[model samples]
Target chain A: MAVINNKNGLRIEKADITLGFIPLTDCAPLVIAHEKGYFRNEGLNVTLSREASWAGIRDKVGLGILDGAQMLASIPVASRLGIGGPKIDMISAMVLDLNGNAITVNNDLYEHLYAIDPRSEFSPLIAAQALQCVIEENKRSKRPKLRFGVVYPCSTQSYELRYWLASAGIDPDRDIEIVVIPPPKMVTAMTDGDIHGFCVGEPWNTLAVQQQLGHVVATKYQLWNNSPEKVFAVSESWANENPVTHQAILRALLKACIWLDKKENRKTTAKMISQAPYIALPEETVALSLQGLSLKHHGQLPEKVEDFHVFHRYSANFPWLNHAEWFISQMYRWGQLTTPINIEETVAAVYKPALFRIAAAAIGLESPSIDRKTEGNLHEKNMLMKSQHIGPNQFLDGQVISVGGIIKYLEQQSLSKADIPALRLINIQKEA
Target chain B: MKVLLIDIDDTRANKLEPILAWTGIELIKLNNHNTDIYQLVGEMHPEIILVDTNSPNRDTLEHLAQLNKASPRTVIKLGNARSESINRLAADAGISIYAIDNIPTKLLQSLIDITLSYFYSIEHLRSEIQSLKPEIDARQVLNNAKKFITETYGLTEEQATDLLSKNANRQGRTITEVARQLVETGSFI
Candidate 1:
């Protein structure tokens, strides 16, 4: 497919296209790109469709029903590797945002956690230990296992929830029950006692806190600073067929990310996404993350945490292969990926950093030269370092889990019995 | 002996009972107004599950997927508008059949039998692919690819096979190459 140099002097193959996005605050970039005319400015006509779930987005994009989508960071990788469902080779040219998810628990659980440890640190370990105590008491009393909800099986929410719980010695699979619930229904599920807590993106977390049904226990920033969240993903075949259009989309989204990073424009963005056609949540609820204000917790004053929702800064939009590796490790650790996989090959195939570089260069936005980096390392000077452990990659257990370390951890952790059937299926397929 | 039929709107549910009466199969009507359909499916392990809705939303699809995972049962979904993505998801989630457009009362028994037979054949093919050992033959791969294409595009088997060969010829590649690509990528041209 040759790129046509149009009258506008822009190299584009397809202008009119449809993009899918779930109704979440992090979908701001896609909405702003459409509503704020960034897409039009880039000589593209983009229609944003609100999908009900991540599976819908994945399937629609894989089947070419939608050109692309705002997807969970792990989705493209999982889809490509056939982890959760069928294998659909998806590529992520740009990341949508970073660190907007938080874990929230019902008021009763929050009260129990507070009674165990009332420190203001919001340490994942302390909260997990308290949960352990609760689990033990429930076991003594013959209560049902606590159920936790996540948006999708192969999402960052599930990984973050598993990571937090695993670090505290709680077996996510054996000790508790984890279920998949849509983001909009998280609050109602928690109120109905269907789920004890949930890990999801805003403004559901904010809404839960606002409704006094639950309190924030840990933000993704605390778990892993500047963690990659959602991405603009498309099928690999689609990207190859319409290279120019793909680059144009990346360019438009880059401009939107830059515009969103501006401090003064955040309030406007929150308002814009709060409209009916977009996120359709209250303006105040959507604005909380953008404002970077303190979040409410049960039996405690609001806690201040900056960088709650990062759109562009810290090279957030760059699709790093290292992040993909981390997700792959999590998938293996959680038994989602039953068999061994080539981590580097799978990650490189899914994350198109070269396309991101081209789009960023077109807009004169400086992007990282390297595609891989060490995650969980937080520091001031080398925040965007590509390699050479520039900062602290510590988890709650004081262990800095790197790619190699995670592989070892997976080896040490036995695969749960529940995953045996899936593994057997894979084994059968491999034998054939 | 038993079939579970769930429809939130009583219109389609009422019409389904008369259609299944001739089969002598005991039909269990479930009030889909209840939100916890997944839990209900677990409680009542029916041989077959049927759902009718005006439009199948993500929630309904997700619940169906959950039911498929928790209990391996044949599921058939009937909706008004045809959605390629929904059909693909149904296939991935192990749903036997997803029929769009209004149901013709006269065709109910035949459709049910077709769905069950298709599901059994697919299951048999999966096991055959497994037992073949070490190398899945081209014919098996082609059969699976054709099945995927027919499901995704709502095409007949012959049409899907013709499309695969035509695309392969256009690309100057063999049918095996094209069929393998389709099976691996889960996509069709």
Candidate 2:
């Protein structure tokens, strides 16, 4: 039921909307759309709400107090599966940004890991292995389990933190206590000795390093190259009702993402998002990662790691169904989601690739013809030139999840609690 | 039954304290934002916890509800069973409710209705006072304008009122507007 304005040649179901966002650097898409008049250009009045927590954003969006929000990539899927929270039918049509999170450990823990293996600072896997040795020694001496922090129970940071630990044979649940801390409180918690390490989105990691409170042990990009991070999500009911307005928002975000990805605009973005109403951190702290510099250690020069915070390149905005499957796989592996479900059908319901295609096509961009693709197969050499439909998708442990092979991938994961046979039965039933 | 209120204003909490106390509901108010929510919730084990919807501590509480059975989980279904009431609770009251499992929806609804009416009454009085403020100010302006008219033109109070009414009727404006104009500008065109 879209009512068109003949004068403007655009029809918006709901013109005035309030969208929620945490004060993170990746919230640039929503902020840019609002600040740069992209929303106004589309004849939409969008008020960007600076939310306090992911749970606040999730609940507000669920209750329709928010029209939509920038959310963790796993939220819509997790909410749909009723894992880690109440069941809420949510969907995401666009990925906001990719690989903006990092795992940081307190200076004392970092020193312990570094003493075991000097290369821990350079390699995520080696850092995990070194941390494993430290964990073993602590257990032998009857020390308490190391506590880690994440932004949410079902966030991508939680999954990434677990995946990094499991790479070195450390069980996240059994070996360490993972606590949920608000992103802004993460550095304070680390300083107060409450959490030894945390995996969160920037610029908290940057702030911790600047304060000499922590050292970056592993980054999300190193865990899985260019993996999906934050996404623009809305409740399924809201999308169904405001189809036209949703499309308009998607268009505005896409344009903003394109403008953000250019190398020259990175500094301006850092400065813009660092304002009082946005991330509110110093521009230099937010500028490091946005400018492709990965600061892993204190009293050292930051490493040049391009793609540290990918906004648009490499078909990053496409809501890949396989990416949704990966989050579900982690949920199952961690025992956060136990009930068997049709993996393909579930991912399709949560990630709207068809809607993404419509939005992409209207902007004269080419989306991948297929909804799902094999992850962790493409490397840097293969993606040297500009690619319209693919990007670097390699994992830290060299694990590749071929299309429709999520169950097989989960079966091979270390410390997995997934019942592969039951999952297969559900998938087979769906196909039949 | 124990209920914890986090970040509610002191005056409102004080008003709510005795009202809830009469029903044997012990209310513990947590005003410090720096308090460790997990440790407090673990120790207090309150059946129902009320907090602002936008509080930064809500996420840590959500994590606690996910990991610990003793902690109160969010009351999502209350918003679902009767959305209108829940919307008013969130939008007007700006509060979110979390309660342990098996708390009946009817009980929660009644609690919400009580809280809503309490806030509504306070809000009702505040708004009533708010609406009356302009009238009081206008009366002052009218009196000052009458005095100005009497002192400058040697007109009677009735004559001043008649002149203001005439100007208001001619300009199709409120008498207050004409009176304010004369009081501020010392002239009514």
Candidate 3:
């Protein structure tokens, strides 16, 4: 029962590790890290298995069923705090990618966003405004406010959607209701009119726009440039026993990042990720700009270079404590979990910079010079999210009380039957 | 308070003998296949209703939704649906809650009391506090049926719940009864 630390743990470089990944667009680096022979190059043996759900991914890692897996950035924070289901100490050795997520309004909503704004000129911020406006306008028309979807409760997709919506003066809870939907079904849900819109990660976002079921109103990276998204994660115990293996995997994955980010590899990577076995998306839907260039949205080259998914280059491989803590701050803000924790120590423990540094130095790259200071622009002064009424920059994480009493507080906010019409709609609709 | 316990398996009545031991309530178990359980639920007007998960006999939650309008006094307990994520997600999406088996004796009674007291009222909510004296306990059973269907079949919350309801009803038993049918019969369908 002694505390876990580096003193007596098994070195990661000495062990072979099994990594888990889901077949999403961003799992590319982890898969590519293995495919490109980076693991072998770094003196590590790695195995990759595709998982079904984020819960399965978390549980397998928690129970030591798998060594580690690709995880949403919020997962490590949520798992340690024991938020979503159970608490198992997990850590991130490196960020998998950023951006590549967008809020797609259903076709009806997209058309309204375009037609209603007198200045039909597109802005994620305006589309955000339009979404809020439509909800309010619907209230006047007595139509039910929209119910939007996010992939999971503990995800950047939910937070970013809330952040993006709030920036536009929309109340995420009141103006619209947010629920979880699996990523693969998001576009179909939008097309079927089961949900008004959704915030999800890659290929799906691309799917919505291409199918004309929805439009990408906001990219997570644009809302907050280089915002931390997914991570390559492992359980604390696994990391402890397999330190050498962990470091080797990180080094290998870092090399894969470098290779994936290159212009020549970008096209091949897009085609590979889009295959039926991966995201099950058509290659045309996932076609990243063949030139390894930036995305063109609304006839504009997004001013943010980090708006698309980033595998290698920059400080991508160096797991930042700030990046991890920022999500804690967000979890606190969104009331996902209660109370603020010792952000510095917890984030530091979870980010696993020691392993990251070892991996980086092994790959002949300089580690990030910034050791502790926060990165990225937390201040979204220029952005307009859909749920703006919940904001005005005061308590941005929307955390008033600390994380200590979160469940009780958030439970109090649970919707009553009167708040939204009871789900007897099936019966009512069945009769009607 | 009185509870109407409807099970396709007659033995559950024997198993539940201890559950209704101390409470100021009467437990009535109807395991017969031909019983008009839904009509009886409305007629008897029990404070809480417990139906077998396998009842091809009834869509208990769906019936609860309907009963809530005519007789808001009756609250139905979908006790066996808490085993899986798809079930949990389905319950959460449907704005209801279920209690799966294997809960501790105390917690199980507390869950029964919560349903007996009705969830929305200040009085039932008042009972919720006393039941957890030291501190509030928030624990729900891990619905295996939910986990089984979601992981094995990749079914959504709505789909999994619907499939369970349909199969159970078609077999003319409770959902728990039908679930066991699935398990005992040993075919995934």
Candidate 4:
């Protein structure tokens, strides 16, 4: 690529570009980057296109129609593994945000669970156990399987929903039905009785609770503290051809994320993204969660969960290899991917920590020195007060996965269809 | 063979239905956004599905193809030779194609070619009419300007044309713009 230095003194390969984003609150980084002049600060002209669906975004990026996009964190990995959609080589150097999705059950389902066990309102585990009882009763009555909606087939929401369902011995595939619905239409689908519950990002979950149509059963934060939700991904070939341009975009997004993490700026961020060209929702609905209020129940004050949407704090922007492995492990556990491949090699190709380090360093920010870390090891004490570099990483089931222990982690998950021996044999061969 | 046309509006679907009728291809048009796509695809078992590239229903169709391995999957791996045409199919026609594995590649290619030509023809006529209207309107304005100049100033048609051209060149504007302004205001700025 020819390097042309702009007036800003950055050697940008391609300055005029178009990016795609779905109308979710986590699309904040890209929107803020464009709205706040961060992209322009880096001598780049960017257009943010509002996409109708994740599939459309994926295909456009694959076909080079879009320069890059805000994608579900699992999409790049799934795209590489050829799991749910077309096999396209995609990569991400930075994670946009973490832990902004929640699972909501319709009012009737919530009432049933509450009737079975009152503690279900306070505890996600208790709610799942109660749901087990409700499922049993529905089975005895021979009613059709309750349908649950997710944003995409190979999405973080899908895996989180399955992880929550499998917590109480409910087979997500056999015990209930799972369908894909776009985020914008989620609440309307629930109102029309097309789905009994759904797992999606805000402000759909907040909108559902506000309309009194559903109650939040569990949140992605509660399921896995500070898990990755959305990422900034581009085609691998695009990254190779425009390395400087990619880094420029990443640096701009990092600046946007740093600005988003500040408490005072969040209200304005919410109001800005709620305009007609972006999310196009009411400011209050979008502001509730962006301002760190988890509105899980109607007719009650929203709980203050300050880390509800972590844009930059706690090394959140770093694209850890272990996170990519977690997504791959989920794909195997759910039988979405039946083949066994080298997990380390695949993640190394898809999640470029080396690139993230470069971008983070350019802005004089501190990133994690290592690319992999043990999950489910941090407690509240380790991550409290915002003094630590990394935040609490705990799983609801309290399963700890070592750096190279993804196969072992997959072996422990219930309702998993993974072939451990096969996986182990292939990975060991690759290691040798 | 069963072919499902999803989210194609009435006008386009009407044009495609007849072209596909005589080829032994049964076309099923689904434009409703609220339909249970998974259930419909499962029962109908369409060998080929064509959906709008930007349709909100595309995600559900993707999920359906993923959940059922035997179902009609997206034609993603049409080899390096056909990828350019696939890009054209998406960028030009705004369509995404899905078909079962056993479908012949030649048949798929012909279907894509047919759809692309159909869209191009319609687009061609639409643009032609759009381009012609402004020219016709410009001619009417120029004639009106010339008649007013000849009747008011006692100048011949050639003199009026020369006068308008001189003013258009002096103002660095198109003749149509100067004529429209003259006809509207009875004088040029």
Give the TM-score (vs. native) of candidate 1: 0.73
Task: Please report the candidate that would top lDDT against the real structure.
Answer: 4
B63: Cα error in model 2, Å: 1.0
Q: What does candidate 4's lDDT look like per residue over A1-432, in tens digits? A: 344575447688798889999999999999999999999888789999999999889988998889999999999999988777888899999999999999999999999999999998879999999999999999999999999999999999999999999999999999999999999999999999999999999999999999999999898999999999999999999999999899999999999999999999999999999999999999999999999999999998998988899999888999999999999999999999888898889999999999999888888988899999999998766755665367888998989988888888898999899989999988863211
Question: RMSD in angstroms, all models?
Answer: 17.5, 5.6, 21.2, 6.2
lDDT of 1 by residue, A1-432 (tens): 334464347678787889998889999999988987878876788899887777667766776778999999999998888656546889998998888998999888888888978752467778888888888888899999998988887889988888788766788888898887878777888888888999999999888988889888888877777788999999998999988888888888988988887879989998999999888989998998887864756345556555777788778898988788778767766656657656667788999899899888888878788776654455434556543223333344444445334454344443432243443333222111
DockQ of 3: 0.02
lDDT of candidate 1 over B1-189, digit per residue (tens): 456765524654454466566567678876544366557656776555564322223334443444355443212222333344345433433232222223353354465554444445667898888988535588888999999988989999999989999999899998888999999987544
Candidate with the larger DockQ of 1 and 2:
2
Q: What DockQ number belongs to candidate 1?
A: 0.06
Which parts of model 2 have CA positions greater than 4 angstroms off? A1-8, A381-388, A429-432, B79-82, B125-189
Worst 10 residues of 2 chain B by lDDT: B76-85
Per-chain TM-score, chain A, candidate 1: 0.89
DockQ of 2: 0.56
Candidate 2, residues A153-208, lDDT tens digits: the string is: 99999999999999999999999999999898899999899999999999999999
**What clash count does candidate 1 reach?**
1
Candidate 1 error regions (>4 Å): A1-11, A298-301, A380-394, A401-432, B1-34, B45-189
Off by over 4 Å in 4: A1-4, A7-10, A381-384, A429-432, B80-82, B122-189
